[model samples]
Target: MVDVEIIEMYIPNSPSTLIYIPGITSSLTQPELYSTLHQTFSKFGLLYQVSVKNVDSEYYTYIRYYSARAASRARAAALRGEIAIKDSGPVRVTGLSRSGFPNVPLSRYKCEELANFYLGFSGWRSKVLYHRKEESDPLMVKYVSVVSLEFPRDSVSCEGAGLCEQPLASAEEEGDSYIDIITKTAKRSLGEAFLAAWGKVLLIVVEGSKVQVQINTTKEDQFLYNPVWDEPVVSVSEVEYTQDAENEDEV
Candidate 1:
């Protein structure tokens, strides 16, 4: 019998929120300090809000971005260590597993865009690109598959459960080493289970009712539809339709 390994995953509750712990002692009460932090983080992406909190002389800043991809990029860059701040010591940046603020409604359309961006594509309408690499040796060929996914409108919340590492049959049963089994399983399952097993999933909550879950999968049909922004569209016509109708009646 194969023994499966169940590992607890560390999934981020909010991908768009990041936490920054400054090395130097600074006061959040100061306007200049707030401005400096805001300006510094804004270079990575569009920021929805910036806030600072202090507990026991320890200062922490929560920076929220409009797009999860932007927050992810900022976190990756910050993880390299020692982000410099003007008139202060270098600070360390880390992404928050869960947002400290109350739940803010996120547009379902925007969430889809963010997911596609993380997968290394311009938009959900874009085509999936597959790259094949051939080494000098015939046995070393590699196959890469790229997939895009979008959740249904009913999805209310998303969570990361961590990597699902299942063990294969024992040496006595299959005559394969543990390492070999693990390698084969990871490669085969990683691509198909990447979003559900590793990536963050967003949930959409309906008011006064139960929440619905939307799983991320290949959005082949969604390619025909471009995302529509929430903002109202302005008409280009200088004259009103009512005025045009009145002129036609006069004629």
Candidate 2:
């Protein structure tokens, strides 16, 4: 692996209710994550800070490696998001398998109270990983839904979505690197876990999106917009879509 390091930052928006988590095989820097967050949660803010760490080639090793950083980032994200959002109503956390654990204290924005959406696998199992706390607050978690993204029960759809691209094995064999299982899971699971824990889910999948379809579209566009996954994620000027493919002679 050639110096695979991940950078963590918040999406910074408000009136925020929904949160989408990415999957384990990749990082949240993927365009799919940006698009979903940009479109579905438009106007909302992201308050979490991700910790970049070293991962072994065994992506699943994250369960052990990144746990500490995940905890800190979860707490930080929670604090930042909580303060930024005006909605005192329930917050949502949505994601795939590892991301199902977003409820665990991996970022500032993590907590049972903030859980609103959960799209994941082994949800109950993931939630089982959190520490118990006494409830001083009177609110019951407003859980959205738990959609399993595994083999058999493989899909769903909603007004919003969380998309992720997996690490290509060919890239793995060569020097191309990828995020570890811990970061991937931490990024992926929390929101879906929230749903499984809470229950009123509004799940949607991109069964079919037009090439021109738009989602995760953001406001003001002040973002760290880098599409590359193996290095630190950054934001730059948006790229021109090239509008039309090559005309007959232009090809």
Candidate 3:
């Protein structure tokens, strides 16, 4: 194996998150790139989440690991510039500290109207609450449903207009809660509609009566007209690295 020099671009204070900037070569969509990175990085350690974003037609992958050590090791390996995808050149990896990656205010609203407005959807009557914290971060909020809904066959009506209704007791007899049944039905009926409205969605997960919608807000800053994660992780510049090198020589 060829040994490439490891350049510590930015050492984050916490070192739990690492950003990967891939060379321009692949034509995969943001969601597809996210899936590929998640699967590849999952081998290193337990992952909290993986996000992909496009800036100026280039792709960047932000990976957060549960173990800081795992992130550090990944960063070292990535810095060597050895990791690469088929048809893509080596990627640049930079470690991010907690202070480096600032968390934006996340707000959860109970009103469907507000949710619809933020989600950019119209004629949506489901009681799906919206939770948003970052306007530009690639990883958005995840909605998990605990109980499902029951809708009439012909009219497709839910129990409440803006609230998730409790599952019926009879639903337990069939080994599946009413919430689970309704959640699946809703995904089948309204999943496409939601995807069309919210282009940032990464994946949709349904467990029992609950449905989890994972949002990917990559490049949202451009569309939302706001900048959140666009700021540099650290205030310092590359000069810090040169100063450290000179200090080591003096020692």
* Best lDDT among the predictions, by candidate number: 1
Tell me which of candidates 1 and 2 scores higher on lDDT.
Answer: 1
Candidate 3 lands at a TM-score of 0.34
**Candidate 3: lDDT over CA atoms?**
0.43
Per-residue lDDT value at 183 in model 1: 59
lDDT of 2 by residue, 134-246 (tens): 23222221112122222123232112112223334544566544444224433444443433332322122231111111122231221122224224477767865444466
lDDT of 1 by residue, 108-216 (tens): 3344444443322432232223222213233222333333343344323322211223434333267766556545544543343333322334332233122334444
Error of 1 at 75 (Å): 1.7
Greater-TM-score candidate between 2 and 3: 3
Residue 104 lDDT (model 3):
31
lDDT values, one for every candidate = 0.45, 0.28, 0.43
State the RMSD for candidate 3. 27.9
User: What does the lDDT read for residue 194 in candidate 2?
Assistant: 34
Angstrom error of the Cα, residue 212, model 3: value is: 31
